[model samples]
Target: MPAPERIPPGRVSSVDLLAKGELTVRGRVREASNAVLYCSVSYEGEQAHCVYKPVAGERPLWDFPDGTLAQREVAAYELSEATGWGLVPPTVLRDGPYGQGMVQLWIEADPSESLLALVEDEEPGEGWKAVGFAEVGEGRTALLVHADDVRLRRLAVLDAVINNGDRKGGHLLPTADGNLYAIDHGVTFNVDDKLRTLLWGWAGEPLPADASRTLTELAATLTEGAPLATRLAELLTSAEVEALRGRVGVLLGAGVHPLPSGEWPAIPWPPV
Candidate 1:
């Protein structure tokens, strides 16, 4: 494996280190469950909330080298940046005496929110509204419907192409200004059969026009050897790309949808 990317420690400044608390208990906005520490940090001189994943003495569900996962995460963020997804960005992947971890831009938690909150909130001027469907009592519920259904459908197609196996409610972050963000991609782009997630409840539905356009754009960019594709090729194999393409085709095909029959391990209980 390649050496983990190095980010300067203390680069964020002391004022940003707000508090170290139990994220789950405190109800902080967390992108992953592996490790959590809440803090305030300055990103580009702007006061930003941040989370630190301590590398030391923590356990991950997978057995990948701590260093490699951090590097892959950094790479994933870089890809997101290149795609102009605004979902995630390149973060500080770091290593210390404790082991290896990452420092990511923190998203504020919605105070009066639940997964259903997105649907109720109105779109703000020039802001992205984070909206998705939630599984409610064996049926699908629209969580946030601020954006046009077309845009949401396109994002769903993108998720399929990425084979994102963990598109849970917590992964969706909506800025008060209206921008929706997706995080926690460590489990994606792997050369394995782990493409499971909760967002595929509407599998057989026709691809919304916006989604078809986005997929066409992504496919064209990949065929033309976009830098993002070059990077993905490094992490994923030809077969993986083919599978992604196949998934896209399936989503676009007539009367095709994801059929949920058995319980999946990756899906959290009482999927939010």
Candidate 2:
């Protein structure tokens, strides 16, 4: 990834920069399933790097409605902001050169931060939580584990609330400033129970105190006619919005991390 061009001194907010700036296609992230254009957005000479995913470039998904992935991405960002966790970067839906799509602040992850690991031991040692077992080829198996850090725990709760269908290792972004952000939310907010991810280490565990409180607050904000509810209505179907509310209620009622539903695959293929 190339460094973003520096902007003259300014104080524009990231959301403002993304929503109003002129986008210049700097490059493309070819590894992404959907069209991911790496670009720089400049507003009044204040420039910053961002990712642009045009709705026209989205691929069809049998499970999700067509042309709605970009909206879902923005919806995920809204939910993340409502949680006060800021786990997802600043994202907005706006008209781009290719058409309307999702634009989000581009973050550079720290190369040295190790959040997931595979170990030969049956159980994970200190500072780690075991997810399950994975085949490492040659008929060998290893324990899939993730860090026991609170940041990841909070993200797990957020995932449950949104019913994220793909929480692969690549989506976890940890920066050098001690901030962790998650991305690629196009498959989230489905009405069905499709919470697939590698962060199942906390399954069946009691919800952390902070998480419980946040869920309680989120439930209130998601009630019918509320601001968040109204905003989500624009992005998701009525059924999906209702399901999101029900999910929060369920979390508050259950008071623990949810275990995977056998109805769907517990982990996404190519987990990393």
Candidate 3:
């Protein structure tokens, strides 16, 4: 088998890292049922601890094709880089453990922060935006949460841009560096109106100026024959890519955050 791909440790595009690197499987991530492994990669005297998800181990989904989730994860990283938000840690796809899989730099997060509790605050605290409330059975206190942190706000916009179908709370991690990383994007970029997420806190609100600019840039990147378009062509279906572009245009035109269309459930189950 061709050796695993690797890249410079800290400062390269996901494309660069994924395109080059020698991968070595270190161990398995026992917490997951679908095989996830810990890996180490190195190239050019640079090394990184990474997570690798081999295509051979992915569980089949009725709604999504088999062996394609790894590619979607890479696509999400690519989109994150295109937006210049640095919200997704560098990710790439290459040969690994069992076969070709998605590989990404492992971000260690602060143990101090609990995004769930932060959002569950009853009051709309500073730096937070409350979405709504849910009842717990009959007499139990209703559950409430507000998506807090400007980083989450950015992710909300990105989720919309990708037509992300799963943005569960556990997918978010607050790094020790104080930066937030959004992970587990294997189910994103569907060619449908499926932006279910836990980030509806800013629903219908105006987009942040910078977020709008990023969307505009992304639209340009999706134009025919653009670099991003070319890369995406390798991973996503043509229809899905077109849908991504259309969604960007829609967001730009609306100039505000989107509200649930009610065509599907707006949130994922077991939110955190």
lDDT of each: 0.50, 0.94, 0.81
lDDT of 3 by residue, 12-121 (tens): 55455545767778888786647788877766667667888999989998778788998998899889989888889788888875888988887776678766543344
Instruction: List where candidate 3 sits over 4 angstroms from the true fold.
Output: 1-19, 118-122, 134-139
lDDT (C-alpha) at residue 144 in model 2? 95
Whose TM-score is higher: candidate 1's or candidate 3's? 3
Model 2 alpha-carbon miss at residue 21, Å: 0.3
Task: Count the clashes in each prediction.
Answer: 12, 0, 7
Candidate rank order under TM-score: 2, 3, 1
Global lDDT of model 3 = 0.81
Residues 61-90 of candidate 1: C-alpha lDDT, one tens digit per residue: 563434344544555565455445546633
RMSD (Cα, Å) of model 3: 4.0
Off by over 4 Å in 2: 5-10
**All candidates: TM-score:** 0.60, 0.97, 0.88
Rank all candidate structures by their lDDT, best first, as comma-separated numbers: 2, 3, 1
lDDT of 2 by residue, 1-272 (tens): 78665345668888889999999898999999999999989897788899999999999999999999999999999999999999999999999999999999998888899999999999999999999999999999999999999999999999999999999999999988899999999999999899999999999999999999999999999999999999999999999999999999999999999999999999998899
lDDT of 1 at 191: 43
